[model samples]
Target chain A: MTALLEVDDLTVGFERDGTRSAAVRGVSFEVAAGERVGIVGESGSGKSVTAQAVMRLLPLSAEVGGAVRFAGDDVLGYDAKRLAGWRGSDIAMVFQDPMSSLNPLLRIGTQLTEGLRRHRGLSKPAAREEAARLLRTVGIADAERRLRDYPHSFSGGMRQRVCIAIAAACTPKLIIADEPTTALDVTVQAQVLDLMDELTDRHGTATVLISHDLGVVSSFCDRILIMYAGRVVEAGPADDIIARPAHPYTRALLDSIPRLHGELPRRLPAIPGSPPFGTVPADRCSFADRCPRVQDVCRTNDPALEPTATGRPAACFFPLDSVPVEVR
Target chain B: MSRFLLRRLPQALIVLFGVVTLAFLMTHVVPGDPARLIAGPNASAATVASIHHELGLDRSLGYQYWTYLRQAVQGDLGTSYALQGTSVASAIGHALPVSAAVAVLGVLWEVLLGVPIGIIAAYRPRGLLDRATTFGSLIGLSAPPFWLGLLLLYALAYKSSVFPLSGYSNPYINYLILPSFTLGLGGAAWYARLTRTNMLEALRSPYVQTARAKGMPESVILLRHCLRNVLSPLLTMLGMDLGYFLGGVVVIESVFGLPGVGKLTFDAIGTLDIPMITGAVLFAALFIVVMNLLVDLAYAAIDPRVRR
Candidate 1:
C-alpha cells in the first residue's frame, strides 16, 4: 500500500549574501496511515526544518527541492489557494514553544474555534462546542469557561495541551508536532506526551514527532529516524534501532541518553565534538570527523543509506556491530 | 476599569496644575504687557494704569495667581482683554471645535492612509510598493508643515481650485482638507514608519507563524493576527500624536486661517492676551491628560494581560 506521507530526496537551503547552504540534504522518509514516526536529532539537525518544509510553511527565502506527497498527491505543486485549504484540514502542526505558538492577544476559545470555523465550516455555536470538546479531550477541566480566558491564564503544560487541541480540532490526517513538550517541566512533559499519544491513537492519526529526546520518541513512536547535520543518518523500527543502533552516530546518540538505574560514572560520555557547524562538504560524510569508527574511505566518499545486516537502513560505510557497546 | 480611571484622575489634575502654573509664570516674565497692548500704543500712562487695575494686572504676582486659580476652579477664566467682553473660555469655545475638527480629520487621514501603506510595505519588503512608500514617507517627514501646506494650497487650491485657498467655510471639510493633510502628513509618515517596523516585527513573531501554519489566508493573518498585536505600539504613537495635534497646530491653523484653538492661542501670544493664553494652555493640558487616560484604558481592553 502507498504510504500516507512520502518525502523523497527532500533538501532545504537558505541563501545569504549570494551563498546557498543546504540545511536538509537529500532526506527521504515515509509514514503509513495510523503510524507513529519520530525524527530524532540534536539542535540544527534540520528535523524541524524538514517538518516545516513538508507542510510548506517555510519562509519565502527558503529554497525547497523535493517531492512531498500526502496520500499519493503532490503537495509541492499546490498554489496558495490550494495550499491554504490543504493545511490545517488535511495536515496540522504543533510548535515547540507553547508560550509563543498561541497568540497572546486572542482568547483560548477564539484561537481554537477559528480553524474549526474556517476549515470545518462549522457555525459559531457548533464550532465553539467542538472547541470545548477538544479542550476537554485534551484534559483541560472547565473547558467551556476556560475558553474565554487568554493564553496567559493557562500554565505551560496546559498551554501546550491547548495547542495540541487546536491541532487535533479538525481531525487532520497528519500531525507534525515539533518538540511539543520541550518547553514544559519534566513531570508535565510526560503528561503531555501521554495525552498526545492517547488522542492521536484514538483518532487514528499519523504523527511525525520531531524531538531531541530519544527517550520521548522511543516511548511514543513506532519507528524512528536519526538525523545528523541535516541528513537522515539512520532509520529503522524503534525496537531494533534502540536495541542496536546501526550507525555510529545513532549508537553515539543512544549512548548519550543518561541511565537512571546504572551506577553513576565519573563523567558522562558526550559526543567528542560539536555537531558540524554550517554545511559539510557536499561529497563527504557529515559525521566523519566525530565518528569513532571512521575509516580512510569514509572521508572521501559520501555514504548512501544502505540496508544493514539487521535489515535497517543506515548511511555508514561501516555499520556498528549489533552487540551493545559497553560504556566506560 | 473605573478604579483605574479614579486612580489616574488626581495625577492628571496635578499635571494640569503644573502646566497652568508654568504658563502663568512664563507669560508673566515675557516683556509684552496686555494692558498696554489693549489700551493702544498711543494711550497715556494713566489709561494703561487704569486698564491694568481693571484687569488686576497691577496686583502682586502671587495675589493675581491665587485669584486666577480660585476663579478658574469656578469655571471662570476671566475675560479676554484683546477682545472686549469676550470671556477667555468663550473665545476658546468658539475656536476649539474648529481646531478639534482639523486635528481629528488629520488623525483620520494619518491612520487611514498610513496604517495600510505600512502594512503593505512590510508585507512586501524591498518590493516596488515598499520602496515607493518608504521614499514617500521620507519626503513627508522632512517637509515642514507650513511649506507643505502652501505647496498644496498653491497646487490644489490656487492652480486647480479643487479646494478653497484659505479660511473656514460651510461644509468645513473643504477648508480643512489641505490644512489637515499638511498637518497629518508628517505624523502619517511617522505612523507609517512605525507601523512598518512593528508589522515586520509582528509578522516574524511565533504567533503569526502559528497563524500561517493554521492555513489561514495571508490577509487574515496580516489583518487579524498581526495587526491586533501591532495596536499597542500604534496606540502609543497615536496618543503622543494626538496630544501634539490638539495644541501644536498653530502653523497649520494660521496657514489655513481656521479659527481653531491653536489659532486662538497663536493670536493670544502675539497680543500678550494673558487670560486667553492661560485658558488655552489649561485646555490643552486637560485634553492631553484625558487622551492619555483613554489610551491606557484602550490598552487594557485590547490586551487582557493588562486588565488588572
Candidate 2:
C-alpha cells in the first residue's frame, strides 16, 4: 500500500554570507497509513526543517528541493490557495511551542471550529459541538464550558491540549505532533503524551512524532529515524535500534541518555563535536571529527546509507554487525 | 470607561491650572502697563491707578490667581481690557470656531492622506513611492510653517490667482478651500513619515507572520492585523502631531490674515491683553488634554492587552 506521506531526497538550504548552504540534505522517509514514525534529532539536525517543508511553512527565502507526496498528491507545486485547503484539514500540525502557536486574541472554541467551518462546511452549532467533543477526547475536562475562554486563561498543559484539540478537529489523515510535550513539566509531559497516543489511536490517524527523547520515541513510535548533521544516519524498527544501534552517532546518543535504575560511576558518554553549521562539507563523513573510530578515509570520503547484516540501514563504513559477535 | 475618565480628569485639571498660571503671570510681567495700553499712551498716573483698581489688577498675585481660577471654572473669563465691556470669554468664543474649523479640516487631510501613503511606503520599501515619500517628508519637516504659508500665498494666491491671498471669509462659502489646504499640507507630510516608520516596524513583528501563515487574505491582514497593531504608536504620534498642528497653525493663520485664535492671541499680546491671553492658553491646554484622553481610551479598546 502507498504510504500516507513520502518525502524523497529532501534538501532545505539557507543563503548565508552570500553562499547557499543546506540545512537538511538528502533525507528520505515515509509513514504508511496507521503507522507511527518518530524523527529523533537534536537542534540543527534538520528534523524540524523537514517537517516544516512538508507543510510549506518555511520563510520565503529558504530554498527547498524534494518530492513530498501526501496521499498521492505532490505538495511542492501547490499554490497558496490550494495549500491553505490542505493545512489544518487534510494534514493538521501541532507545533512545538504550544504557548506561542495559538493566537492569544482568539477564543479556544473559535480557533478549533474555524478550520472545521471553513473546510468541513459544518454549521456554527455543529462545529461548536464537534470542538467540545474534540476537547474532551484530548482529556480536557469541562471542555464545553472552557470553549469560550482564551488561551491565556489556560495553563501550559491545558494550552497544549487545546492545540491538540484544534489539530484533530478535521480528523486529518496525518497529525504531525512536533515535540508536543517538550515544554511541559515531566509529569504533565507523560500525561500529554499518553493522551495524544490514546486520542490519535481512537481517531485512526497516522502520526509523525518528532522528538529528541529516545525514551519517548521508544515508548510511542513504531519505527524511528535517527537524524544527524542534516541527514538520517540510521533508521529501523524502534525496538531494534534501541537494542542494537547500527550508526555510531545513534549509539553515542543512546549512551548519552541518562537512566533511572542503572548507577554508572562515570559520567554519561559525550559526542565530541557538534553538527556542522549551515551545511555539511562537500566530501567528508559528517561525524568523522567526533567519531572515536574515525580513519583517514573518513575525512576524505563521505558515507551513504548502506544496509547492515541486521535488518536496518547505517551510514558508516564499519557497520555495527561487523564489530564482532560479543564486543557490544 | 469610568476608570479611564477618572485618571484623565485629574490630568486635565493639572494642565489647565499650569497653563492659566503661566500665561497670567507672563503677561503681567511684560514691560508694557495694561492700563496705559488700554487707555492711551498719555494717561495720567491717577487714571492708571484707578484703571488697575477697577480691573482688579492692583490685587495681590495670589488673590488674582484665585479669582481667575474660580471665574474660569464658572465659564466667566472677565471682560477684555483692550475692548471695554466685551468679555474675554466672548472674544475666545468668536475666535475658537474659526481656529477649530481650520484645525479639524487640516487633521482630516493629514489622516486621510498620510496613513495610506505610509502603508504604501511600508508595503514597498526601496521602491519609487518609498523614496518619494522619504524625500517629500524631509522637505516638509525642514520648511518653516510660516515660510511655507507665505510661499503658498505668493504662488497660488497671487501669482496664479488660484486662491485668496488674505482675509478670512465667514461661513467660508466659496473661498475657504485654499487656507485649509495650506494648513493641512505640511501636517500630512509629517504624519505620513511617522506612519511609514511605525508600520514598517509593525510589519516585522512575529504576529504578522503568524497571520500570513493562517492564510488570511492580504487585505484583511493588512487592515485588521497589521494596521491595528501599528495604530498604537501612531495614535501617540497623532496626539502630539495635533499639538504641533495647533502650534503651526498659529503662523499659518497669521500669514494668511485669518481671524483665528492665532490672530486674536497676536492682537492680545500687542495690546497686553492679559485676560484674553490667559483664556487662549487655557483653551489650548484643555483641547490637548481632551484629544490625548480620547487617544488613551482608543488604545485601551483596540488592544485589551494594553488595559491589563
Among all candidates shown, the one with the greatest DockQ = 1
* Residue-level error in angstroms, candidate 1, position A34: 1.1
User: Can you tell me which runs of candidate 2 are displaced by over 4 Å?
Assistant: A16-21, A123-129, A139-148, A265-273, A319-328, B1-8, B29-36, B39-63, B120-214, B239-248, B255-259
lDDT of 1 at A19: 84
lDDT of 2 by residue, B1-308 (tens): 79879877997888778888898888778788888776687888999999999989899988998999899899998888787888988887887777777777777777887889888887778789999998987787788777877787788888998776788675473345666666677777877887888777766664444444444444655675577667778777677656544532577778877788878888887888889888877777777877788788888776655665
Candidate 2 has an lDDT of 0.80
Runs off by more than 4 Å, candidate 1: A325-328
lDDT of 1 by residue, A1-328 (tens): 7799999999999998988788999899999998999999999989999999999988899999989999998999989888888888989999999999899999999999989999999999999999999999999999999999999999999999999998898999899999998999998999999999998999899999999989889989999999999999999888888988899998888778888766766776789988875667878898999999999988899999999876899999999876855532
- Scoring model 1 with DockQ, what do you get? 0.77
lDDT of 1 by residue, B121-206 (tens): 99899899999999999999999999999999999999999999888879888998888889888988988988999999998888
Report lDDT (Cα) of residue A161, candidate 2: 89
For model 2, name the residue pairs that clash: none
